[model samples]
Target: MADAEGDRITLSALQDTQAIQGQTVILPTALGVAPVETTGDPRIEAGWFDNGLKRARKELGQADRSVGDERLPVLIVTRYLVDGTLHEDRAIYDLGFALDGQLLGGTRVRIRGLSLITRVPAASGQAKLDARWKQLHPKLAS
Candidate 1:
C-alpha cells in the first residue's frame, strides 16, 4: 500500500497502523485455482477471472472488519494465470465493501486498460489448436 508521502507499507504494518483514512492500498487477487489455458473454453476462462475477483473481495472484507474503520482506499488488482503464465488484468480503483458479502459494484468494475508487459501469442490454426488443447488439458482432452 502507498501512503500519502509515497512510502510503501507492508500488510502487517497497515494492520497495526492507525488512521490511514486517505491512503491507498493495493488488494491483489489470488489465483485460488490452477492456471487456466489461454486457448480453453471462453466460459471457463471468464469464470476463472470472476473467481479471482470474488477471492479479492472476500479478503478485503475480512481486512476491513479486522481494521475497524481504518479502511484505507483500496485498489483491487485482479490477476489471472493463463496457459501457465501469470497476467495482471484490470485494476479497479473505486470499490465499496460489506461484511459477509462481496465488494459493492464488484461485477460492474470497468476494465479500463490492459498493461501487457510481454505476450507470447498462442500458436494459430486448427491443428495447432488441437495440439495445444491436448497438451494443456490432458485429462479433459483424454
Candidate 2:
C-alpha cells in the first residue's frame, strides 16, 4: 500500500524498509509461478514505465467503486539470485487493480522486460528476446 500523502510507494522501499530482504518475490503466470529471489537492493529506473500494454492498464470506466482515482505504474529493478549468482533482472511494474471481486486487466503487480540478469544496456536484441522468452517459456529460459 502507498502512503496517504500521495507519495508513491516503491517495491524496493517496501522490501527494504519492512525487513523483507532475502524474500523471494514471486509473480504467478498461467504457465507456472516465477519467483525472483533478491540478491541486493533493487535498482529503480523511474516512477513508471508504460509499455502501452492494455493488459497492464486498469479500466477507467464507472465501475471503480473502491479506492480513490489514483492509478500509476511502479517498476521494480533489482539484483536477483539466480543459480547462486547475483544478476540484474527485469523491471517489474504494477498497474492492475481489482474491481467488484473480479480480476481485470493488468495485475496490481506485474513484471515486464525481464531477462537472465545482465550488465549490458538492456537494449540489445538478445536481451529483449531473452526477456520475452522467459516471460513466455518460463523455466526453460531460466
Model 1 per-residue lDDT at 48: 33
Clashing pairs in 1: none
lDDT of 2 by residue, 1-142 (tens): 3433222323443233233234333332321223444444333221232222222222212222334332222223454444455555434343332222226543232322222333234455344433543453233221
For residues 120-142, write the lDDT of model 1, one tens digit per residue. Answer: 23232223323432332233221
Candidate 1 Cα lDDT to native:
0.29
RMSD of each: 17.5, 12.6
**Model 2 lowest lDDT segment of ten:** 44-53
